[model samples]
Target chain A: MITFSKQQLKIPKLQRPVYLVTAGQSKFDRAFPDKRTEELCIDSFTMAAQLLEISPAELKTYIHSCYYGHFADHFGDQLLGESVIHDRLGLDPLGNIGVKTGGATGGSTIWEGMKAVASGYSDCVLVMGWERMDEVPTDEGNFLISCAADKDWESPLGHIYTGYYAVMAQRYWQIFGKSEDSFRRTLAEISVKHHGYARFNPYAQAPMDITVDDVLNSPVVAYPLRALDCCLMSVGAACTILCDEDTAVKLTKNSKNKPLRLWTSAGTHTLRPADRMDMDIPLLPNETADQYKDLGERFPGGDRYPGFTGFLAARVAAHYAYGMAGITDPTEDLDVVELHDAFTISDVQTYEDIGIRPYGEGRTYVESGDCYHTNPNTGQPGKLPSNISGGLIGCMHSVGATGIMQTFEIASHIWNRWEEFHGDENIWNKFNRQKPKDWTNLQVVGAKRGMAISHAGVGSHVTSTILMDPDHLINKDA
Target chain B: MSMFGQVFVKNNQYKLKGDFHHMTPNMPIRNADDEWKLLGVTNPRAMTYMHSYGGEAVFFESLSQGKLMASRCDNSDCNITGTIYMPFRIHCPDCLAKNSVFDLTDIAKKSATIHTFMECQRSGAFNLLDKPIKFINIEFDGVATILMSYLVVGTPKFGMKVVPIFKTTGPTYTILDLAWVEEGTKEEQLPEGFSF
Candidate 1:
C-alpha cells in the first residue's frame, strides 16, 4: 500500500486559497431519454448562473476555463462534452479538459477547477459533472461500470462490481463477528435511514416511506447485499463555480449566498484490493492511540488483522484534508458532511474510514440516531447529520454528478438557501417520517465547517475536501 | 426563454403538481416507457482486437510449455532488482531501466496456497462455466504478487493448498490455460517431475 505519512506528504499551505461562489444541480431522475448528456450539463450550468445572479452570457464571460467530469463515454455520444458545454453556453474557448476518475470524477474535477484558480492560472473556473446511465439497459450499464475493475484478471473471472463489495461486506462480517441476523439488521437500518431522508427531497428518485422490513424483504442481488442496499442508476448533472478569495468576496458582496472557503482538499489512492492485505483491521499507531480513544472504543473487537483496512486511501485523504484545515477532531470540528454511499456498506464504512465514528462501529452511530435529520430528544439535527440531500441512496446515483452534487448540497446548507428560496413554509416537514412539530430544515444551525468525501473503485480512490465559513476559519476561538 | 429557464422558472413547486408529479412506486406511473422505436433494423456485429500483453508474454510462453512462471527486475545497478511481478514487467517499474530479457524467464513450480477466494456468479466476458464460478487468489511460495485464477474445487476455504491443472487442449497460450485443483486430490495424474 502507498504510505501517506506526514513527512512524505505534508499538509499543503496554499498561497491563494480558493472559494466556491455558487453551485447548482438538475433534479435527479431514473431516466432522461428526452434529453442528452450535454443538455443536462447545460441545464445545471444555467441554474448555477441564476444562483450567482448573473445572466448566462455574463457568467460565460467570467469563466476562464472549464472542467467537465463525465463517466461512461461508452453510454453516451457526448465524448467531447467539455467542448459541447462550452460551445452551447456561448463561453469563450479558453481551455476545456475532461476529468474521469470513475465515481470520484466530480470530486476530482472540482479539485482540478479549484487548483486552476488557486494557482493563478485562471480567475474563475467552471466545474461540471454528469452521467446518463439509465439511457442504456441496466445490465449493459453494469458491464460498463465493471470496466472500472481490473479487466484481464477480475472482469473475465465472473467478478461483477457488486460482487466486489459483497466480498468486502462478508469479510467485514467475519472480522466483526456479527451474527447474520444482526448484520442484516445493520444494513437494513442504513437503507431505511437514507430512505427516510430522501422523502424530504423533492428531487430524490426513490423517496418512499420505506421501513427496515421493506429493506429486509428486498431481493438479494448478491450475498449480504440486497437491492435496497444499492444506489439507483439515475440521470443527472451538477456544476460549481469556483474562484479565488478576492473574486468570491466581490461575487457575494451584496448577495445572500455567502462564500464557503475551500479550506483544503486532498486525495490518495491504490488501484487493486489484493495489494492491500491489511485493510480489514488496521491498528492505530501507539503514539496517536490516546488521541483517537473514541474511535478506539468503537473497535468491533477482534484479533486485530495486523494490517490496514481497504479504507486506507479514504483515511489518508481525510487526514490530509483535515490536517491542512487545522482540524484535529472531525467529530467536533465538522458541522455537516456529504459522503459517497454507493452501497449501504459504503455508507457505514465511510463513517469510520473518515473518522466520523470509530472503526467497525458505524452501525452504532446509525442506531443511536446521530444521523437523523432531526433528533428525537433535542428536536434538532445531530452534529454532522449526513445525507441531508438524501445522499446517493435517496438522491440517486448519477455517477459523475454525485460528487459535485454533494459539494453543492453542503454549500447550499452553509448558505441556508432553502428558507430564502422556498420561503418559511416548511414544505419538507410534512414528508418527514416522524413529522415533528417544530422541525425547520436539514441545515445545521450555526454550522461553520462542512466536509465532502467522494471516492470510487471499491474504495481504491478517495477525495476528501474541507469547506469552512470564511469568518469562522480565521476566528475559531469565538 | 431558454429551454431550461422555461421548464424550471414557472415555479420550484412544479413537481408537486401538473404532469411532473413524482409519485411513489405502485402509483399511477408504474414501469412506463414512452419510446419511439424504428422496427426491423438489426445491428449485429462484433468487436475484435489483438491485445498486446507486452511483458506478460514471458509468463504465458512458459505456461504453454506446461509450467508456471514468475518474473522480476534483475538489473544489478537498478533500484528494485529482486522485486517480483506476477503478470510480468518489461522494465523495472521502480528504476525504469531496461531489464535483462532472459532474467525474467525463470521457471515457477505449479503450487500455491489460496490467499482468498470468491464464488462469482457473473462474468462480463460471458464465460461462466459453473453454477457459481470460484476464483482464487493464490500466493506462490517465493513470488511476491498473488496470482488470480480459477479454483476448480468445491467450497474453497481460505489458505487451502492448491496446484494448477493445465488445459492440454483449447486456447493454451493465454493465462486461462490452467485452472487450480486442491493439492493431493487427483482427477488426472501427471509425470512426477519435468526438466525446466
Candidate 2:
C-alpha cells in the first residue's frame, strides 16, 4: 500500500501572513466574440480597483509582480498570452509568469502569488486568470480537453474527457449511492440548486429556473451523468489582489472592503486515475481511521481508498490548508464554501473529499438541504451554505478564471456585499441580463470564514484557498 | 493529392516521408445581425504529430503479436519489490529503477475483471470508437494498478470477467490496438481487426 513520508506530511508554514484585499470578475458567458481577452481582463482588473475605491493605475502601482493563469494556449492559439495582458494592463515592467494546472490553473496561480507575498518576495501581487474556450468548436474542445489526460492511453478512448470522469461517477453511484432513484434525484437537486442560485448573480451565466426533472431529462453525455449534470463551458476573466499587512491596510483603508487573511495550499495525485494504487485514506483532522475501517463492507466496492470514488488531492489539499490555517473542523469552523462542481456527481464527491461530509454520506448534504442557501426542508438558513454564486455547474467553468471567481464569490458574502453586488441594477444592465423579480439576497449574516476548492482532472491537482476575517482567526498563533 | 505522413527511426533520428501538414485558407465569419459585418476568421489547418512511446514502446508493439507485456520492479532491496504494472511503467515509481518487462498475456486471459466501467454516448473530434463506448477499467490478479480499456464483445458491468483482444490484423501501434472482451467470446465475435 502507498504511504506518505514524514516530510511529505509536514504542515507548511508561511513566513508572514497574506491578505486578499479585493477581488473582481468580468461577465461570464459561453463566448465573448465581441471583445478581446485583454479587454475582459482589464474589465475585471478595473472592478478590483473600483472595489478598493481607486483607479487601475493607482492599483497597478502597488502590484510588485503578476501571476497569470490561462489554461489552454491552444484554445486561444496564442502563447505568452500573459505578457500581452500585462502590457495591455500597462504593467509592462512588472515580472509576470503563467500558471496552468488544467482546471485548477486559477487556484494554482493564487497559490503562487500567495507564496510571493508570504515569503516577503513581493509586498503586493496581482493574480489574474482567464480562459478562451470559445475559440474551438464543442467537439474539438472536448478533444483538446482530453489532451490533459494521458494521450497514449486514456485520450484515445472516445477522445472525450467526460468519459474519464464518468467512471468515477459510476463507481460512486453503485457503491455509495446504491443506484437508488432517490440518490439520482439528489444529484439532480444539486443542478437545480446551483442554477437557481445563478439567477440572482448578474455575473453568472446559465441562470435557469430548471427543475430536478429537467436535469434528469437532459441528454446523457455518459450514463448517470446528463447534459445538465455538467458545468458550463464558459469564457471569462477573474482577478484577485493579494498583499502583505501594511499594503493591504493602505489599499482598503478608504473602501468598504476588509483585508481577509488568505491561505492557499495544493496537493496532487496521479494524473491518470489508472495509475492510482491502493492506500490508506489520508485522514482529515475531523476524520478518524475507526470511521472507515469497514468501508469496504459498508459500501461493498468502496474498499479501495480513492479508487474511482474520491479526490485524494482535494482531501490532502484541505488537510494542509486546515493545518496551516488552524481550522480543526470545516463544517463547524467555516461559514461557506465554493467547491469545484465540474459535474453534479463530482460536486457531491468534493463534499466528502473536503470534509464537508464523511465518505459515502455526501448525498445527505444535498438531500438534507444543508448545501442550499435556504434549506428547502426547514425554510431556515443552511448550516453552512455552499455555492451561493452558483458554482461552476451554474456559473461558468472558464478553466483559469473559475477558482478566482469562486474566491471572489465567497469574499463577497464575508464582506457583507453580496446583496450590493448581486442586487445592483446598473450591474445587471451592464451585463444585459434582466434582474429576476424573485431575486433574494443569499448573504450569510455572520460569515467570518469561507473557502474555495479548485480542482483538476480526476483529482490530479487540487488547491484549497481559505479566507477569513482577521479578527475571526481560529488559531491566534496562526 | 499529398500522401499520409509516415516516419521511421534510423540511427536515433527520424526518417520522415510524405506530407506532414495541410494548409487551408481562412474564411471570414460575419455577424448576420449587423448587416453581415466582418466579425472574425476561421483558422483551418491540420498537422500530424510524431510521438515516441520511449521505454514503454515494447508494450504497444507486443499488442500486434497478441502478447500483453507488463513491467515489474524486481529490486530485491526495494521496500516494494516484485510489484507488477499493467500499463507498463518504464521505471518503478518508488525505487526509480528501470522495470523488467513481464509478459502478462496468459494471466490476463485467465483472470481479469472489470473494477469500474462507463458507457459514453458522445465522442470528440477524430474519435475512432463507436458511440456508447463501453469503457472499462480492469483489475488483474497480480497487478498493482488497474488498466483502462474498451469492451468490444459485450456490455460492461462491475466484476464481469474479461479477456484481452489485440489488433493483430492491422495494428495501429497505439493503445487502440488493445481491447477487452467478455470471457468465452469466440474468435468470430471479435471486431474485424482484433483477435484473442
Candidate 3:
C-alpha cells in the first residue's frame, strides 16, 4: 500500500495547466533514405501544425521557442545539431534548445517545453525529436549506440547495449526464482501481446501475429533476449505543441475534444550503481512545504538507502509522478500507460516499476493476461491497457523521437483521434501479412487519464509525465 | 496519406556494406569524454571489434602486474565510507568533490563475490570466443564499485567467491587482460605449485 500521509501528500496547485493541443509523427519503419532528418522534422512539425489549422507562417509567428531531441549526432548527416536543422525549416530565429539524454531525449525535450510554457517563458513551445539510424550500418550503429553507456568503464569491456539489458533480465529472473522455460515464455508472451497491438497501430514499425513458440524459436541476440524481443531500429520523427490552457481553448474552439492537463513532468539520473540502489522517490514538482517537511521526517537525508540499484530511478520517477497526480493506485487509477519497452523483458519489468504489480511479480502479471485489453482471467476489460500503441517493442525505436511519440499516443487517446491516423490497408498488408484481430474498435473506450514514461537505460535516466482529460481535472461537478 | 506513408514505396533503402568496413585497427578518435583517449580495435580486414580503455590506463597496467587496484577519495569529507571505486572515478559522484591531483589507488583484495552474471548465447564486439561470453559482475569486498569482467573458467553462482586471474602473456592492458576464476579453484591450484 502507498504510505504517504494525506498531510504529507501535497502537490503545488498550478495557476493554469499546460495543454497538449495536438501532436503528429512520421510513419515508423525501417530506413527512409530518401528523406533527410530535416525533412522528417518538417513532416512532424507541419503535420502537427496542420492538425490545428495553423499555417507554417502562423506556426512560426506563434511558437516562441523550440526544443529538438536527437541521439548520436554521428548517426545522421547533420553536423552541428538538430536545432540548426530546425532553423533550416524556415521558422523564426527564436533560439533552439537541443536535448540529448539517450533514449529519454524526446521525453526530456517535451518536459523542457512543457516547463517553458507553464512558466510563461513562452506562450507556445514546439518540441520535435527525430533520428536517422539507417545512414550507418548495423556494426557502426551498434558502436554509436554503445557510446550512450559509461564509455571509460562499461563500453570498453565489450558491453553491448543489448547484452547489458539481457544481463538485467537474467538477474530479474534469478531474483524471482522463475524457471528458465517459464521465464522465456513470459518474455515471449509480452512480445506476442505487443505485436498483436502493433498490428493496429498506424505508426508501428513491426506488426505481426507471432506466437510464444515463434518468439522462443527466434534467434537469441543476447542470451535470453531474442531478436523478436528487442525493439526494431528504425528511422522516424515525432512532434508536439504545448500551450497554456487559455491558448489551447482559443486554438481548439472548433474541435469537439478538450485539451489534456499536463499534470507533471520530471526526470532523474545517476551514473553510479552504488548510489542508485535505493528506490526512493525523486524530487517531484508541486510538493508543498509541509510535504517536504514530512518527507524529511520519513526519509531523512544521509540515512537514505544507498544499496538500491540504478533501475530504481524509473520506479521512483513513476511513483513520484503518480503521487503528484493524486493517484494512489496506478493499476486502478490509470486508464492507459505508455512506457519505454526497449526489450520485452523491459516491458514486463516496467509494469512492476510503474506500480501496476508489486516487484518480481511482473512475470505473473503477464501470464495472468492482465496486461491485455481483454483479460483472459475474468473475461472483463483490462484494468490498465499499457503500451496500447505497441510501445517501443512494436513501434519503431528511433532513439531520439520515441518519447514524444509515446506522449502523442496518450494525447491521441484522450482526444479520441485514433481513426484519423490509422495506417493505410495496403501498407499494413505489405509489412504485416495477417490482419489484426480487430482495428475497427481498437481504442481504449473512455480513457480520461493516462501516463507516458520514458527511460535512457537500466534506470540511469528517466522521465515520467501524466496527462489527464481537462474535463476530469477542470470540471469538478461532472 | 500520412506524411511518412506517402513516401513508403520510393523512400525505403537498405545498404549492404557497413560504414565500419573501412575502419583500420588503430584509427584513433578521442572518446566523447575528452578525459579519455580511444583507439579503434576493428581490423581493416577482420570484421571483429573491441575498445581500448585509454583514460584508465593505470588500472590495466596494475592488472598486468597481478595487482587489483581501485581509486579511493583522499578527502575524508567527500565520502562517507572512504570506499574505493573499481573503475576509478575522477571525482566523487556523490559529493562532486574534485579528486586531488594524485588520486589514491588502493590495492583491491584478491577475493570478491559474484554479484551478478549472464551467460550469453552469442558474443558481441570482441569476436566469438571459444565459449559463450560469461559476463560476470564481481563485487570486491569493501569496494563501493562493482567490476564487470568475464569468467574464463568456472560457472558463476549468485554469491560464489571468485579471484582475479591476469593474462600472463600478450596482455592487451585492457579489461581483456583480466578474468575471474572460482575461489575454490584458486585455492586448489595455489597449494599444488608452492611448497611450504
Error of 3 at A270 (Å): 3.1
| Candidate 1 residue lDDT tens string, A300-417 | 4232332223477677677667667777677777788888888887887788777777765666767676776666557767766788777878887888888898888888777877
Where does candidate 1 clash, by residue pair?
A278-A307, A278-A308, A279-A308, A279-A309, A279-A310
TM-score quality measure for candidate 2: 0.99
True-vs-predicted CA distance for residue B150, candidate 3, Å: 1.2
* Ranking of predictions according to TM-score: 2, 1, 3
| Model 1 chain A: worst 10 consecutive residues (lDDT sum) | A278-287
TM-score for each prediction? 0.81, 0.99, 0.81
Question: Quick one: ranking by lDDT, best first?
Answer: 2, 3, 1
Looking at candidate 3 chain A, the ten consecutive residues that score lowest on lDDT are A301-310
Docking class of 2: high
Query: Model 3: residues >4 Å from true position, as ranges?
Result: A1-15, A272-310, A423-440, A474-478, B1-57, B97-110, B122-131, B184-196
For candidate 2, give the lDDT of residue A38. Answer: 92
Q: What are the lDDT scores of the predictions, listed in order? A: 0.67, 0.93, 0.68
List all candidate RMSDs to the true structure: 11.3, 0.9, 11.1
True contacts kept of 2: 0.78
lDDT of 3 by residue, A1-478 (tens): 1123555444444555678887878878787644667777787887787777767677667788888888778677466666567677776478777888888888888878887887889888888898888866676677667677776556654546776777666666665524468877888888888887888876788887899999989987777788888887889999988898777887667654467777554545555343343334433222223533343344232122222212555766675566656776777777778878899878776776666765445677777776777776887777787787888889878978998998888887777776555645664564444446577545677888888888886667788878888667523321
lDDT tens readout by residue for model 2, A428-447: 99999999999899998899
Query: Model 2, residue A130: displacement in angstroms?
Result: 0.3
